[model samples]
Target: MALKITWRNILPGCFKAKSPTSPLEPRNQVSKTNSLQRLSLSDISNNGSFFSASDISNSLIGFGSNLHIFTLKELEMITQNFSSTNYLGEGGFGPVHKGFIDDKIRRGLEAQPVAVKLLDLDGSQGHKEWLAEVIFLGQLRHPHLVKLIGYCCEDEHRLLVYEYMARGNLENQLFRRYSITLPWLTRLKVAIGAAKGLAFLHGEEKPVIYRDFKASNILLDSDYTAKLSDFGLAKDGPEGDDTHVTTRVMGTRGYAAPEYIMTGHLTSKSDVYSFGVVLLELLTGRRTMDKNRPSREQSLVEWGRPLLKDPQKLDRIMDPRLEGQYSMEGARKAAVLAYQCLSHHPKSRPTMSNVVKALEPLLDLNDILAGSFIYMAPTEGKKDNDDVDIIGNEHEETEAEKNEHRNVSEEEEAEKKEHGRHQHRKGYRHKHRMRSFRSRAVYSDTALYRTYRTSFDNPKLQGQDIVN
Candidate 1:
């Protein structure tokens, strides 16, 4: 009989291997690359050939036939011998370079652009991370998930190939100076796309916890459609009666769920918490942690959570660059959702599905206008406009009426100022310089592309970071 093999059998100690024996004992740190290497040796033994290309190709779990296994020579040619001119950006993994592949190397595939990410042998991430990305992205496919085109694993060199995201990541768009400000509607749309990706991961047959759900990991394509990338820290969720998976804490500091950070308990809710932080960034255009900012304002959650519920303070917390283009009702509802996700108790947070539902209506322009009109409807035939005295005479409208009038005027004035600012900004484009954040280095080429292409595509799609 032919020897039967399954993913579990091929990789006996996979992600779902076993829980730590003791709460206090450190979890096993065996690198995934080592495990796969051993498995490759076993495959060679079974096939009676060392380093047989066909056998090696068929040995990878779930990825054997589906993904293209590129040779080091092939990638070298695609990236023009790893020229610096093609450099994209660097992350924990290593420096990424832009590349192109034609029908010659990939039969039936069209000539297209791609981002090639080479693993830094001495970087913080290692072979295990490179493998983790392939395993997770190889199996998971969604519109909002970044596409993993292929990978290169020959000798000591490890690399990944991905679809080129023209727009890049949310981090650069939201915080990078001189970047095109994402309008309220575009921001809402991006949020919904990202939330759907997370929801799909959380609601999978075997739930996946996206341990890293920060702005840097949320990429955008040419149309400003957000997609989640960098699955190095992704983990399988709990099984059966288990409530949570216990693993060593690993994630960006400000974006990590407090419960996960405190106790090493991983759950779908932990990803929800991180999503909330990104949502806040979209709303406020502020970094989660900025040492350059005032000490009290550095932690975005701690400082912004209380203000989310206060309508009067909403303007103060919102991104000034937005210039009052958003609907008040939509802002309020989004703020409420963010508040729930950032709750101190893990259970208090909404699931990614619910988060998606809550955001959908917020993007409806008609609904926002309708809700605003109803909220501002005149009572007792005191017309809505009667509250404001244009003659500059002090007539005591009710406190509510005065507040409403002030808010309207503020929004109108903001719009006018924003228009004027845009006109003035056009003249300074040539002198623009990208300011880098200490948290993540900005690649010069990527910045140049963002600046040059700001007016090329739909204005809404221009800003953000692209990953390899």
Candidate 2:
């Protein structure tokens, strides 16, 4: 049934955005490195991946992708000829403009706001990147990954359309100057959502490694639900006996895995290391590399990693923007997880699924802690101890919460002894991370190849075909 699409419905309430091409400062467009000195031109552009626009157009039907094929003229009309008022912001990819789509506009595309990304032909990324996004986001769907609605590939022009994320990227939300700081619970929630997205990729049938997992690529919806974006640098993970994918070292400088930068050994663990960096950014409210800070404090991982393990040192590194809002336990656990994920040894990092398990328990901690007065800072003379004077309230934690925390502590201690070398000292497997916010296991670590999936059907559009 085709719903009536009125002009009023086309420009929704949020569509009245004011602009002269720039509203908020655009998110930082970090430079992506080309392959090493030995690689040829084809290798640097990831031509080996066979993701040409024409190639995708011919094979997309077989890939089972149901994405709409939009014409350039259709997009121009929706975006008001790429008007300045409709312009959202720019990134490394290209300038994005706000647009609307409905069944009236394209038959199968739902009536909703969208962001149209016009590929900058002369810019850093090109058709290969565009095709990668169309293929990856085309076939793979998850709650945490952004929805790629459709695309236009016409006469040397390439564009991608995605669901408009209200709050924009995590980089703008977390690091934008003069913006409201992200609360502790909200940060944890975003972390969990982003981690789930990565977990879904790594847990897929042919495991995907999101080559670029940085703050700017994680967008938030109106509800603040984090969704992974930008599949430009994404690649399939190694299979069978293969341990790692050797590819061009292409990723933003600060977020790329050290081992990958050193040897081009791309693995799911590389993404984990990047996640750890973002987690650290969330905890500290700082960029991975901030030259604005003192020379000693510029590199977040360098200055912050040492403080994560020591509960006493944890507060010194926490985001001062939080204003003593996070519980000591919650903060410490997050730091420890960040520490483990930032492990120099790839094998020492926990999987994304495990990262999700660890983050889930933290969701409820802040609410209970704040309301029950369980997370108050120690008063003068009680500086060394964490025992908080209880407030008279029904918000107090039940005995079960205490027992659960105790059990988690015991398990952590046992795992501590299993530490192998310097790298393994911080690493632990999946079992220890999930100790239950609600005391329920929600993920499967044994899912070798995406056995653990929540079904989602991409809407099939029959209106147009790709212009090859």
Candidate 3:
């Protein structure tokens, strides 16, 4: 009898029965003999014929990939015919599903789970974006960039297999309703990691412009390490003497740089601007744009930019969710870096390398401010006062939001949360006030620390879950 496969057993990575490989023929002679060619995004953008998925196997191979060819039947078998049970989430490309591969499938193929992204025929992105992802990820390999294990092109179907990121993306973690605020040091660690990923891309022999840089595109692993994923909009940096690559203006609404939006002149600085927006999001615990918010406060960059430059206004814009437990000096340094990154003048912006430098030191500044961030749970008759501060409309979680924290423990567990909390109670402005993030109120030094830990970890493990 054929065994049934599902999401639960899919974890820890396994393999199903093997099938024949795809029939798409390699048109060009893939030369592993030559040095792996770093793809030029500009070159690919200009040549329409070069973007053909069926015709690019040889080139991808030349760029450095054995190019494991998987047939549609193999993917379907592992994912249980792309059943809803195994579905991860949807992005611009299409719906992704979790799958597994092991030695049973192919010898020497490590036993591991993978995230498979299949292109939606009628989706916003098409073969071009899919092709771009193949070229960039195929050749470029880095610690912080998501690994493209293999891909499938059978007839009209296009699917990409990536190393499964257990924690999912940064967007959901940061913006999810009622979600415990990410610890200040964890936030800093993520920033540094993401910066390193971008630095590796920009610092390439011929720089690559990561046109699509946003919170959603930054996927987190079990360690909360941020890896830049989805290179559909990536472009190869311009050659010698070319100041910038002029291309169609493309990126998420609030994250795109002003100059790139107006003139279509793309540069590494454009990514820096987008990075700044994400950094601000991390710093203030806000979205890049929220239509639901007030008209004046809709654009987080505009509202937060002014506040970032003014140190006195730091607390006003700092994620109130932090509750005065964050590093004051570190926050100040991060704000200045964010301000510099958000500069209107592209030249004024620092390179990704410089951004990495600015963020690395902040991770070491874990000295918690000597104050208490007391959050009293919302009661129906509660009034806004010195004690009852409302945070971003008191996030109301829908069924979808409630189920969002799955597979995220690794990020929290490996984040050294216990050590961070141990420091939280070491110094407090108020020693005897305890508050339940849920529906209760008490005050004590020990209980306050316990409450803080309890509220942050919803379904995630606590106390025993911390990494040693």
Q: Note the Cα lDDT for every prediction shown.
A: 0.69, 0.69, 0.71
Candidate 1: list runs displaced more than 4 Å: 1-65, 367-468
Q: Compose the digit string of candidate 3's lDDT tens values, residues 202-271.
A: 9888788898888888888766789999898888887689989988877778888999888899899999
Q: Which candidate is the best by lDDT?
A: 3
Per-candidate TM vs. native?
A: 0.69, 0.67, 0.73
Best by TM-score: 3
lDDT (10s digit) by residue, model 2, range 39-80: 111222311111222222333334445677788889999999
lDDT of 1 by residue, 1-468 (tens): 222223332222222433323422111112223224323211212231112222223444333325676777899999998898887677777888888988788786668888888999987678667767876786677899998888877667888989888776777766767655776777888899999999998987667888889887888787779999888878878768999998888888788888888889889999999999999998898888877889899899988999998876776687776545466778888999999999989999999999999999886644222101112334456665564332224334566666666776677577667666342121121111111110112223233345546542211212122121
Clashing pairs in 1: 168-465, 168-466, 169-464, 169-465
Model 1 / residue 461 / CA error / Å: 18
How many steric overlaps are in each model, in order? 4, 0, 5
* Colliding pairs, model 3: 41-236, 323-373, 433-443, 434-442, 434-443
